[model samples]
Target: MFKRNIFICLFLALVISCGGDGKEMISLHPMQEKMAYADHETIMLELNEVSGLNHHMPKSLLIIHQYLNNETTSGFITNDLSVLTTDKVQISTINDSSILILEPSNNRLIQYDIEINSYEIISDQGRGPGDLYFAEELSTFNDKAFVGMQGFQLSIFDCSMDLCVYEKTINTDFNNYSIDATEDQIYVLGISPFGNPQDSDPLNSDHNLFHILNYQGDVLNSFHPAYDDRSPLVRNRLSSGGMIKTYSNKSLILIAFDFFPYLYEYEAGGDLTNIFQIDNFVQPIYESKESLHSGFSAGLIYGNKTVIDLTTRVDDEWLFLRLYERRNIGFDHVNVTFTGDEWYTYLAYNVERRELYKLGDDIKTTPGDSRVLHVLDQGIMVNNDGKLKYITR
Candidate 1:
């Protein structure tokens, strides 16, 4: 039997939405790091640049859902995986070996074997010691699976065994938005527990957005990522925090903030390696403190209102970033639509060339709901409906 309430409580414990109680807009300070590049090399993104990413992606990479059997799903939610929410589905691509999916909705972990063209449920859902409670992320190290729990717990299971058992549970006082592990330690990225009455104000708190802990959950190190300190109001909102993902094969972790159009890269052991930024991205202009506290009403007022959110995807050679730009598309408050009023911009950075290129809408419009599920060497994997789709290069 499964404890469904475990996931519900875990979800409520974590899932910190990105929003601001402050009325001011955070200032834009794109990456200002200095490094060497080839002669006449362009690193900064131009406002009118044409990325042309689709020119490279194969129109139809390979849809895996069609290969999967959905005719019978008695023990599952539905036979169709295509309808699952991509954002809620956590993916760990194993190149051509296999792909791992952690579906929190039903609390099940599925393994899609690439060569065999079949999938299996590997991890069972439960709130008990060995069971998975709100498994938001999964990564492998030395053939073992590390499951990131939303409820401030990190569980390591013996993946080499046919039936994985809980090896240990690492406890923390903070909620984990995302987690990754190396041979030596476990790393997580998330926000301070600001909503907790016991937690201090973010601006006054000493904790950083990133944390490094050993297998025993001992805090080895932490880093205070740069913040948009233009004003206290904006800084507080920026403090709501963001997510970080690791490219273990590349020994890199990509970080994206909830407030801006930039990406920060760090080496596995907590070192700032690179700062990538897109300068032309839209930034909200806050004229005064009155505008800073505007809240939802601000999105309604007349003016060129701009809002930005960042999401990132990566492969060995490239780091892909998606920016959702929303604006007030009406002449006035009359006949205005808020939820569906938005456009997307995709930017990819070549690791070898260190250049930023905009991707085409066809390729940019990935099959998934939010970020690409996985970035493989030859293609990208996305969850279309609930089916797995791979867009080949």
Candidate 2:
């Protein structure tokens, strides 16, 4: 039955790629290197100017960008103490004072008051908030925030009152690398330390794991799908890591490792209902694009190969998939952009249709020479640069 289901999925995917009525079609131009996909009425945020702030820049900075309606804004946090960095920096409604700024460079979790521009240190525990989500399931009835930790745990913050309260911890065996939450449930993804400890070997037994937990902190379900061991026709084995996204009602989507290009969809009960496998469509005749910069590669991984990061948009209709390809010794980074529209389609980097649109003019070098630009509703964010910047979109 599983083999039959897999065959059917492959056939349907091929048909969908061939212009099936149910699938959305995207085409890429040869000159255009990266392409951003969105709904027909998608709002485009063009870069205006990099904003200047009077605050002091810290050694380590993290900016969270948020966009709503016509307003775009960002919150800035840094590890430097010489300067009094606001716990929250409001891009819009600066006078309205809807932004909260947190302080204490060493605190793991900080709470902010947007209206007063005040923030309080919530918890010094855990590895800080790597990924945060406002819980819909628990929020409707109570005030709560979900924080995923790099130390393999989830921290719940009770926000029902004026001052948010830090709750206890829910422990899991897997390293909780990334997290996302909907109203009723939280989604966590992590790598198995015992399986794939070494970075060089791709064949490590570490299986990408996903967990679904309810507001009561109950383990609803756990998923660990087997990676495809078959070698790709061209590329080396692909490894999977990074954030997982869930919908308001508890629907889930996650990326998997192994060069096969796999995206899995699971139910709230933790049952795997559908799987999308991306096949590298090869052309019989092809020419290599000249590299402008060399020697630079995506820094996240060791090899010269590219690494991918996936984030879902607010609408939950489209997935923002960014590909970072490292150049040779002296070259800059090359980023190829792609989006997966349907629920069951895996994103492929070289797939012409999924490439990201180039910025300004077409300039080709290596991956390291250039950076990937992201335009949120509020401002512009650049990936290659170490710190996140927010500007008018």
Candidate 3:
């Protein structure tokens, strides 16, 4: 069953790419030379420009949460030092004074008003219209909130008023993992539909990877990372799903794969501009497997200490990445001892300086503790006592 699932995922990537509209696709390739690791250096990031981001540069600090072991938790500290905490919740800056939190566990969309020091559950939990179900991803565009939920559904809410009013829902054709929006478009990172796992030939197109949509859920365009031609590992849908963020003002879309140690930057119009890598680490080691019962070729992995958790954030002058790896974890049905403190590394690249820096190396931190999760606009978001807090310079 384990190997079969891996085969199914790879097979799905091929099928979905081939089953889409027969438009010509754009292929991406990484630079030949990888960025070398430099000495420990810290660059301070400031949230200065706040028009598209909807929040002014806070004088104090704000932080996000981290994914520890197998859990993701975080807290949001308002500019006034008010704290709103939840488990597995994603927060988006609705405005300078308000924020939207997507609490997936309770299926609640909460609007927290920092000025009043209060929060209200704006949307209820259900399968009905305007309800939030297992919603994880959240982004704001044009005074609206885009909530990506389970069952391949996206809920859009109007936040122009005092209360967010649900507008409509978008039913996507793929399994969306993360999302971001520009001033006019929504970028969804998802895997194509699982057509027939037994299908042998992979059509290999960009539409199988990304889906660009308008506010009305109309697919304006579809494209994948420009590296599919260089790396075959990206053909597996499971490994390709990662974090995607759009710098609206910059007109840039940054993509970081969970398993691949590389960052891709593209123009909003689907042009690959730059590729980034920390140190000389390119890819993970994998052993092939074959199923005897079903005669399925499972070739992704067997045992490897690969990147299981990844985060990417790009500021004006620097790009930040946090990579976590686990050991002795086999893809097959073998159990291994739970070894805490598997390896955590933090790296940053300065675009202007054209240098790479390593901030942390194999830090001895446990889960639900002080593990770094994300690189924020102005500070680093770390997990403290199971709650996410920001550490400013």
Candidate 4:
């Protein structure tokens, strides 16, 4: 009887080991924290008063930045019969007239021009544009037109004429880092999620370090610390990710983690400092009964000012908040500055009038499912049926 029991136990252990190796299990660590918001709250803000007020641009200019089935592709509308696949994950606008799209699947970057009422594919460069940035302060080497691709290569394009002049391509392995450049230097934020083995382990370093690269793709300095390492919280299980911004000759790096849904601010070249936490300003409306996994949805920085929109969910309720940072005094935590209380604040462009509004609330006229394409100018583009609509305050 003992021999039979031992054989059965050994067989069970072998089966369990095999199951654990092949299957991925997501476990949420439960905490005794209370829910932030118990009931619904209404917050209203005017749209035009914010600094970067988002007005409906031309429909043709709205490009669908999509990662379908892990494949990167671009199209005008959902059913417009226009679909082009490239090296996946390259989606950015070149200028007001052209959209620089990247397909990482095919390792190609294509420029699409919008003239009159039609879309035309202009150039097909077999490379990946890592990330796209606009504004003068975020451009290193004084290149009016620029695109950063994978393999740490940045292509400076001349957009004055119809044909783009590929001035140069600099190669480096920043580890799939996202680029945000200033006149003097380019800031690349490394995104090493848990799923990617090649990326650095956050728990080991306790901070996500960003490389400050020069115009020639040379590493100048490293900035931005991981939230997990800086925070006083114990054994925190937060995933760190953020958007890089350069303004007033300073780099504004916004980092957020899931363990504690708070936004940490840091100045680019300065000692990695924590300027402000989002929770200090905007109170969380809903706290997850399980575990809250929060992350910054989108962000934009212009001049000495910065704006970030964050998304968090607790239980079945979804929460969104817009935080603003002005010239010198870090982030403004005044609740009255924006809206009082609201169920959801999708994005905030203008803060003077507290322009906080929800996206996809209008379904009757805008007939389509609301899908968040990509965040730009603190505004989100939702696919309304076959058309793209911008949701902003």
Candidate 5:
């Protein structure tokens, strides 16, 4: 995150009020406290026990003073970056000095030097001794690129050299939804295909949606974020509503759930720490489900559901969260677009202070499939016109 300090002078007025007894009192007022709208009543978050939290209130709010696409930002986006298609490139793993882009189609890893305005293709796609096959996940730790693919394969590419060299591959047993790592351990969000027997409601079978694995591809322990037993149809509706995102710092793992205003922290060795939550978000509707039609057809009995879809991108100091209230048809069944009270808001959780900061409604992350979006150290990748638009501090 590049910091260009813009100082603005403010006039502070002190008002002294004189009581009837001739006592003078300084007048004070509360600051804006309410963050945003929520699904239900605001659940006060009591985050008392947390460590390594150095959250500080922003001295100045961030604004998009410049845009970095293949243009502008004083040529920061660079010409080589223009070759990246919007569908193929990912901007989630960027830092202050460099920007990382992952092209899943070809299994290519690109890193752009922000200061020099240049790009380099670090990793290539292949199937030799150390190549990528079905590369579905990409994350960076130190100078290594962690690639997760089908057949439960985890590959590490050494990016210290000019071109990334495949170092080692760890085998696992998960169709990975997302995977990231630290120096000692790796975290995985595996997609479990669970279905009801026929049409009956399903019970909590103690399914583990979160998996913690060692570098050698062995599962140390699994976390079952259990939910109440609901019918498959109901479960399907609520499943897509909330988001489950993870963040790790080579040791500490922060797991955020959008169903409520909470984030769970864990050690690299799978020890649960503190469960952090925000006490002051506007309550959102979490349990609003209705049957579509009594008449049962094999395929399409169209219904509508609105969910508080939450997504997050983690940085060094702040874990950026974007919340969206999306209303769509159940299971994407009907081709017809369903619409309702769709809204979006942004919040930043200071990892150091263990506090939530309301990054005003000015700059926000766009709503999408909740895979790590175009996120940088101090900026967020804006949805652009077939181009990359980045907003930094």
Candidate 6:
């Protein structure tokens, strides 16, 4: 599968480099320095024995711990475990009392009602209407659920009531990581389906970046932000995966790159409004092409690269980013353990105030700290020794 994907990407690269439509993507310059938002308490969430996933609603908190195992536990933050599933699952909140758990392996969704403490399988597994397969990303906006599946497909379901019925499915061209929506428009963030011929270097080839679509999944506009050309092995490796969130009553969009240090803001009309560089945050160290193909496990890949684990929004004023920087540790040993040199940092930005602040002063990653799984209005949710904990201010 890896070789197949690489071949496909190479073929696409060649075709795009040769005959891609020369529609120039807009690039915006970034501010070199980031303004401090304010003094914030130190926040750190480290990985533990258990892996936890969570979704935060306005009035309720859902936690899933010991994931991808027979003993998986799903419940509210203030309550005991009420549900269990053997298959791996991703979750999204439909409301304060109900949530959807997607088992991508099985291509189905499980609806858990917090009020009655009951679980029900809501969607089936298939390519037909209302069915899902290999779904990776799920989110709810205005009572509608958007599910991003493999094969560059997006399925939309109306979950306004207790059950979610299939509303529509969108076949997208690019590979997307996250999805957001307002009342009338949907925003998808991912690598551009089309490559730029103007990019002189294949390593730094321009990615179309973000796309705006209507309820019908018709793309209205697309934006390509300015990024330093880097990745040596893959064309989109340096700028592919990122998170997008809607703010200011869904009139604006905020984007944070996984491998890059800049944050981008776009208007409703798809204009590159502002670009921000957080203070003390530097560019990521790219692994050499040979090192990347050296048979390292996912852990080693993460341990050797800088990555943004997650991004969240607080109302419309605050934007929070969780990032980690790991040491190279040398690629000599095929199977090596990660040392304690990794650093975890969180940055908070006040979009309204145009200020940014680092949440913690300590740069060292703590031992046995719970991994950050989700960000809520109350605090960060983590998994600690097979249990769930919320770190609040």
Q: Evaluate all candidate structures by whole-model CA lDDT and list the values in order.
A: 0.52, 0.35, 0.54, 0.35, 0.49, 0.54
Q: Candidate 3 has what TM-score?
A: 0.62
lDDT of 5 by residue, 281-323 (tens): 4333322222333311112123222223434446555566655
Q: Considering summed lDDT, which 10 consecutive residues are worst modelled in model 1?
A: 31-40
Tens digits of lDDT, candidate 2, 1-393 = 122111222112211133333333221111111101101122122222213311421111102212211223334322211223322221111112121122223324445343344556555532445323321111111255555554556667666667666676676665565566666777776444432455324433334356777766676776754233221111111222444545443354544332223445456556655544333311111111112232111212222333343343323333344433333324224644322211111121111122221112212343224334343333333433223233341
What TM-score do all the candidates reach, one by one?
0.61, 0.46, 0.62, 0.46, 0.59, 0.63
lDDT of 1 at 389: 61
Q: What are the per-residue Cα lDDT tens digits for candidate 3 across 1-393? A: 001011122222322123233322222222121111112132232223112322422211122212222222344342322444453456666665576767667778888665576778889789999998767577776589888764678888999998788999888876667777776788887665433685323445333466689877888776653223322333443334467777766667767676555556668876666655444342443322222232223234433444635444344445555666555532333543344445666555444544555444545454323444545444444543235454443
Which lDDT tens digits does candidate 4 get at residues 193-236? 44256754434534434677777778777654443331122222
Q: Model 5 reaches what TM-score against the true structure? A: 0.59
- By TM-score, the candidates rank as 6, 3, 1, 5, 2, 4
Query: What's the true lDDT of residue 244 in model 3?
Result: 76
Q: Which stretches of candidate 2 lie over 4 Å from their true place?
A: 1-107, 110-121, 125-143, 160-164, 190-208, 226-240, 249-252, 256-260, 273-303, 331-388
Question: Each candidate: how many clashes?
Answer: 11, 44, 3, 22, 18, 4
Worst 10 residues of 6 by lDDT: 1-10
User: Model 4 off-target regions past 4 Å?
Assistant: 1-93, 103-108, 117-156, 191-203, 206-208, 227-241, 249-260, 270-345, 349-370, 373-393
- Badly placed stretches (over 4 Å) of model 1 are 1-43, 46-87, 95-97, 104-107, 114-118, 140-142, 161-166, 195-203, 225-241, 246-253, 267-274, 284-315, 327-343, 362-374, 391-393
lDDT of 2: 0.35
